[model samples]
Target chain A: MNFEFTEEQLMIQQAARDYAQRELIKDVLERDAKAEFPADHIRNIAGLGFMGMMVDPKYDGSGMDTISYVLAMEELSKIDASVSVIVSVNNSLVCYGLEKFGTEEQKQKYLRPLASGKKIGAFLLSEPEAGSDATSQRTLAEDKGDYYLVNGTKNWITNANSASTYILIAQTHPDKKHKGINALIVDKDTPGISLGPHEDKMGMRSSDTHSVMFTDVKIPKANRIGDDGFGFKFAMQALEAGRIGIASQALGLASGALERSIAYSKERKAFGTIIANHQSVAFKLAEMAVKVENARNLCLKAAWLKDNHLSFGIASAMAKQYAADIAMEVTTEAVQIHGGYGYVKEYHVERLMREAKLTQIYEGTSEIQKIVISRDLLK
Target chain B: MKILVLIGNVPDTTTKVKFNADKTAFDANGVQWIINPWDELALTRALELKETADSCIESIVVANVGRVETESTLRKALAVGADEAIRVDADPKDAFYVASQLAQVAIGFDLIFAGIEASDYNGAAVGGMLAELLAIQSVSAVSGIQLENGSLKINREIDGGSQTLAMNLPLLAIVQKGIAKEPRIPAMRGIMMARSKKLTVATPIEVEPLTSILSFELPAPKASCKLVAEDQAKELIRLLHEEAKVL
Candidate 1:
């Protein structure tokens, strides 16, 4: 009903914007260039409550509304998508999933630390053989009395090397396919779990991503999330929430790119006047603004639906698809506006372009989102 | 030791001040409110004291005077790490009125903290008035405070420098910037916990504003700086001595 932000939400948004502009923006270029994670900045964000924006009060969370979470994500992604993902995965993917599905004991042991920003969390679903076809996973979990022996390799896992806890998806019964999928909470220090070398990424290099290999890793049965067959459902539900986060991140990246493009167009001179005076440059900036605004609206609508306990799966998927595509378009146009300067890393549009590409691929790929939308429409 | 912090919700410092058409009062149409910066220092220091001494400290209670807007600020105080918050629900228009309301609620607290001055009115009268009403020892402009047994060791600014004084428990102190840690952002978890924390709002006794607003206006523009030629050093010195009278 109310489209405008609440006073608390506005305050938090302003705080995030102020903090990002003051602390993150200054070093974002350097960190992206050198592929260095800003550990201190991450600590500062944790100190500011960005790390656990939606966590429940009992576990030391901000217990903020979902819209506030999206707002914070949008602000962070506007500065650097890599940092946003690190925060998003910790808040939405790992922590939210556990809190929603974990038992009291599990919450006390796993959710508390992650929600408190004391540890990092990762969602491990994609494997080399099963990227979109998550049900065809080769990873297996075998029940052995009190423990489940897990053995599988998950690739493209975000925060693999740094995460203290991972919500890992594996097959409990290979013959049952999707119905056999199960979610397991695995600690980073488990004996048979080893992290592969960090992936050499093209964008979002500040976010550490790699492969995780489990060689007969023994996990307590208590760590199993929900029922044995509910892993796929839980993973899908978590991704639905994650799609909204990605959409907000896309909106943020586009917004940042568009803002810079506008500022530059107005400042750069051509034919004895500012380039912004040219219809060509002016139209491009206008179009970029339109796309960013549309994407932001969609992201907000999806987040609002989820917060109100409505069925937002289709809306979330649609928003993700539209926002991701728009981000790519806006970032690419932003670079074009910079012309020769945009090609070089010195200008940041090139980095924005690179960052925008990942949003189309992660959470759910643009293609996967279409499938989700079409399937929902057909039903 | 029990510490009490007095919080206030003042117009956000960033908001431009405006006046009503009749010129009788300031326009508050779109003004945003925030926890007074000075009171944040008080709240932070009280929380710090509780953290360091653990069980030796009994509780950290925050008190405020205003409407529901004060509730959010109080929640923020709690999230920043206070144990509880109490709102004296009345819009006291002047320092003395607010202090009178707080004086009625100052019982059982060993140490009390408030901002040296509120940002909205810039009135530095609440601490002294509250102290006088409660008949307790008080100190203002306190830059540092520590608890020792049953007394408070206070470091305060004076005209030329700073001074240190010690007062027994059940005293009042106005906190300044250097008194404690800067306010911390309520983390996701802390924010969630604050929703369920103990926040009590009570009806305050009636009070009247002692001072009324006449009008509001912006401060005069800063005098422009003049560029003095390199060879005019002697002339500049003469101007400073004879014209500007700074000699």
Candidate 2:
């Protein structure tokens, strides 16, 4: 029943807020226009230990709780989602997977650097043919006596240009179907690994996303996570944890838009007085506030469940679906509230609106999340 | 050398000011609290000075004069790399009261830092009073400090320019902006370690306040701007000259 955050959590939130408002907001518009990656900012945040906010301290992480991670994500996402996505992937997918499943030796060599943010990591699951249907992975990892030979095309791979380590999911036995998949950690400097051109994305353009082609890439067998054919369950569990991060990002977008709309409405005058004095604009702001609050509650609930080691799959799915949808709705209303100014990049509502669309499309699409939730409820 | 940074707890800069019923106090409901901007910068500079290998800074301690709720602000100072905190359990009624309370715990520190003024009141008096109370030399409007050859090098903003001075230890520096480039954000490690950092609460000696506020009033709302058509240059000039009275 306690809603108040701990002193540490509040301080972390403030730190993230201060960094985003002071540092990230400085070049966000220019970065978005140029579609440039935030390399320096990434190093700076990693120095701040945001890249592995929830990893164990023994492995060079901050050893923070999931709730603190959610709070930091929300604050950072308020100004720049591109940066937040990198943080999310490294913490939830890369570091969490390694810490939870990797062998002691694997943790010592690979997880240490990744969790310390000395190196960045990426998760490769989706392909051209397998978007929502993850079981239809066409990428194959052939079993060899000493090592596994990996060959696959991973699409929409985030941090493709900058990451040094990748947690790759590929099929090892086609007859075993979904049970045949394995998740392996591969060094990006390995031979026969090439990356396609950075995709020109609609929003979050500052985030580096590309298609990675692996041609007979040799990976150590010791790098495989969990038992044989455990990659599917590992990826699913990681995604369940990752949904909290995305949900918080969406919440940030929604709340950021609402705040801008409120500020703009009070200052912007229309026919006779400020638009905020009008009932129409005021009601829209009220509705946006409600949506943002609900989204925040849902995000926090999912994060809390995860932190408590409770079953958070269904909760996270619901949060991701609701928050992403509401982010789009709220950002659109924020733009409408700004009148003609919302169409441009100056006031920042337009950029927030653009960023909101990706939250619904990435991680797990809204349709897929609905499937997860409905399936869980029926079962 | 041990450093003591005088921390001030203040409302966030973006807070919308609201008065209590009788207009004597600020409304605290929903107001977010933060470390004073200048004080944060002062702490940042202290940390930067400590980073040098040759510097003899042993630890940085932040002291505040406030109630229990101000512990969060003090904890934040710790999370930003201060070694420990000392809170004078009392209401910071006035600059004199605050300086008087701080002087007790601040006696042993080799170097002390005080922001020129708290953002809320802008009293601009605590640093000078503390120096007088402790009978130590004080520098005002200090914008920079560096440790050079075991001596303190200070850069202070003066009328129309700046001046650099070489000073000794056991001095109170009333710092202004440019003390550091930016306030340091607490890293995740610092946040975790802050929980275990020692925050000592000292009992405050009774002190009589030299000033009290009877009421508070906000400045009048700005008049709406009268925009003249771009083509009517003469009209705009006339309005500016007559109404604004700046010509």
Candidate 3:
């Protein structure tokens, strides 16, 4: 196994770093405080072709490998993970899904814009009662020949108001349970579609998290991603790949906090010497560094497996669960290293701590990851 | 007007500089390389010129004097905007040899832009040597450039202020920051298209070396800092006057 990153991968990392350092980081503190969407930043990154890094070039994507996408994700998340989540959903869930399963006409009409950053896309799966138990989808879709009328409320939608296209998972045959679920591509401008006010989130507040309600929304049958009952498999596969994205994001958040602590420790003095000279403080930094490195290896391994068309389900689960846990632990210690400043918002570690919690809970919760792992082992 | 931008390979800014055991040379293990920042900015401006109008500025070419590693940087330049790249196979003996190699490759181009100095060595010599060898007027610390009528106006930063000079085609320039507002990051499509873009490897015109590296050393580290508590104004003043020797 080669440990070195390819030249193209390194270049992608540099481009992402340059853009994040120059543009996304300028007003980031203020934007996080005000919970402002980075529309301009998104547009600029789109110009760099980050929005659809892994999609095929024929479909307006950059046709990059998953490893490159993960590298970009890690870089973007280092400074502003809220912005990275919006990017992650677009690339891992929306773009990858449509490219892998959607028909040619579907790809031509919908995937191109999402791939080109002309429009944002959302993947709708979660609901009030179905967070971890996605199989219990309550959203209903009534078939009407050429179109299907869908009525459902999806909670925790990442780009609810901002997205132009949505992959809505709804039940077509309630009698068949999960086998009845169908995935439809619904436009945001469709009739009877309404978005609730943005949820006041503790962290990642800049992302447009909301409850999207569709009342008798008519969707073209042609917009279905695959065969009638392919929604469950499609979602499972997409989330398996998407877990790598979240794992990389978590790794970024932890590493960013650790880097801040390292810089601060050398600069902040306590007893006639810098705090880093103290063994207690120095050991903590070492531990944080080790954890971040470990998490990066696991995350990259998962992404590398997927890029090679290998079975990555178990590897991805482990990576996400491990990285998410490490993110929380590392950020907490990072704030502690800041002393009382960690409790306050200005130090930024507090924000990272808050943001890191969601990584453990979203995509697939730590508990669900265990289930995925155990199931793979049993099989 | 064909513009040939000279590219240089330098250590990434974040790489820790280290000297060898005998202090004769820098340790080369696991060193990361990147395109010299100033040359990258120059290439970006050349592309910008071509982008604005296709008339005088017809094509942008980048030339580098190194082996495969340096060609990797040129590929990135291609991804950024350079239409053609010429990689000369050589060890980059000195500024004169590098300049001569570039001078040979830049024979047909009307304008040439290169970084004022390479970050690794800070020699600030290649651009001037190219001008001297090619028999063309040259300027350094160029911050900005604009195309007007049939001539290109160049802006240079001097000791106290800035000045602009209009120069005809076929002139060499040593450029700094204002050449472009910012260097363009290669787009994904650009990186994709770069895989197919023409990267020509040229036979180096051998030149006798005029200089050679001798030794390497790192600067001294800063002294340890002393913390001054909020309540110790008198103590701080005493130490500042007695120990620091400034009152």
Candidate maximizing TM-score? 2
* Leading candidate by lDDT: 2
Docking class of 1: acceptable
TM-score, prediction 1: 0.79
- Give the lowest summed-lDDT range of ten residues in model 2 chain A: A143-152
As for model 1, its CA RMSD to the true structure in angstroms is: 5.2
TM-score of each: 0.79, 0.97, 0.95
Which residue pairs show collisions in model 3?
B1-B56, B143-B178
- List runs of model 1 lying over 4 Å from the truth: A4-34, A38-65, A78-80, A99-118, A133-152, A170-182, A214-231, A254-293, A328-354, B22-24, B132-135, B188-210, B220-247
Q: Residue B140 of model 3: what lDDT? A: 82
Candidates 1 and 3 compared by lDDT, better number: 3
TM (B chain), model 3: 0.90
For model 1, state the Cα shift of residue A76 in Å.
4.0
lDDT of each: 0.86, 0.93, 0.89
Badly placed stretches (over 4 Å) of model 3 are: B224-247
lDDT string for model 2 (B51-108, tens) is 8832588899999999999999998999989999999999999999999999999989
